[model samples]
Target: MKNFKIIVLAKQVPDTRNVGKDAMKEDGTVNRAVLPAIFNPEDLNALEQALRIKDKYPGSTVTLLTMGPPRAAEIIREGLYRGADNGYLLTDRAFAGSDTLATSYALSRAIMKIGDFDFILAGRQAIDGDTAQVGPQVAEKLGVPQVTYAEEIVDIKKNKAVVRRRLEKGVETVESVFPLLITVTGTAPACRPRNAKLIMKYKRATTISERQNVSEDYIFMYDDRPFLNLPEWNVGDIEAEPERLGLSGSPTKVKKVENVVFQAKEAKVLEADNQSIEWLMKELISNHTLG
Candidate 1:
């Protein structure tokens, strides 16, 4: 079997699901500093798919590419602990406040720099901005075919990939050739746990910016093991146009943000019986909560 070069697009996003009082700023923007950062959930699914491919094709390599703050290198290390061969962090102040379109452009440029990847895998959407546009937008910018809502990469033959996609009402299978982009969905299998050995090996992985803060004693380890240095690229490194970056390139604007709180007025207790279940379902359907 021919080994493949796969790039997994990942992200470090604010944990919006567990929002607190300090989640938003006075200017209607998210207060990411106050919120906990985590690996995007769907992106983990994408990583699992890439790792599966690498496992099936022994010589294949899984590389992770993420765009975020310098601290985002944490995700790269997380990917390394979970079977990725190497990873890159696209970090720079120039990428701040980027909308999906601008974000995709930056990622596309980075991918071009990496070069020769057979596939690009990313999450269908990010929790921070539930817009499922980045993956497809990156594909469009790179001029590659894209498959969204992918649940599984069923097989590969003759440089073609067979992918199973999840749909609202059903599932569909499609085939596409190499140099394709796929957006994995949460319905896919969860990512495997971090390997103990891999964790120990990659625990010291750090990008240049991160290394700068390290104590002098541990600095030599990074130079000794080059793999411990995760590549961190900025706008200049990727040769991106200055005007088409950050807020300058982002056209989307949020006019207002309102915090909503829901309170139950009443509650009813019922036995865990078939009749109760049927009544609950009927009530939910009647209220348009379920159908």
Candidate 2:
């Protein structure tokens, strides 16, 4: 039909950028087990952008794709509950510890397997790694044009789309052809809150294995009640290129991570009085704390 198929790429990362005591191995690769995982914030923004696009184009559908451990399926289901038409997980032991370059390889391959798509949306950068490289890199792999740090989709037609993007000191509006990639920024509008109706209907949404972890009744109840169940994709279903599906296909690898500890001493209180303030100012100036 050549209609819109929006694919949003998301990631699950550590809650805080501060690595835990055992968060990283002697090698730079992340010891994910030691860190608490959470969804990437900007990716949520990208999801919202896709949803908005669907709202504008009546027949459009949104699909979310992620490359991470199996648990990342949770984010995919979460995307479905938020009104995405479908969710796909690109997971395999072979994809573990992939750097952005490698990770993009896996995601791009899975995306290609998904057939026709109108656009690829992603967060400008993961909170854990502020490099803002993956989205553009994925676009490169897909050989599609990309609009980075996008703030909004200003306009869209069957064959082209326009978007506003944030630059370091300014902004630029772009018009790119369909099947393009777009990476959004936090400055983009926040996603609409979860629709309670959708959540209640799709709350139990799970992948085949995810449902296996629980009682059959649970999944049955949701599936029977379309309002209760949502769609989720598993690894084998997407027909990804096996050699390109995991870590082996990736070129970049994490070497190690060293936590830099900056200790703070006891706090000192300073009076608000003018003379005391002057003394503190002079001391700060002398110590180069202030110019």
User: lDDT per prediction?
Assistant: 0.94, 0.79
Best by TM-score: 1
Estimate, for each residue in 116-226, the C-alpha lDDT of model 1 and write its tens digit.
Answer: 999999999999889999999999999999999999999998979999999999999999987999999999999999999999999999998988888999998987999
The per-candidate count of clashes, in order, stands at: 0, 8
Error of 2 at 153 (Å): 0.5
RMSD of each: 4.8, 4.1
- How much is the lDDT of residue 114 in candidate 2? 78
Quote the positional error of residue 243 for candidate 1 in Å: 1.0
Candidate 1 lDDT (Cα, 0 to 1): 0.94
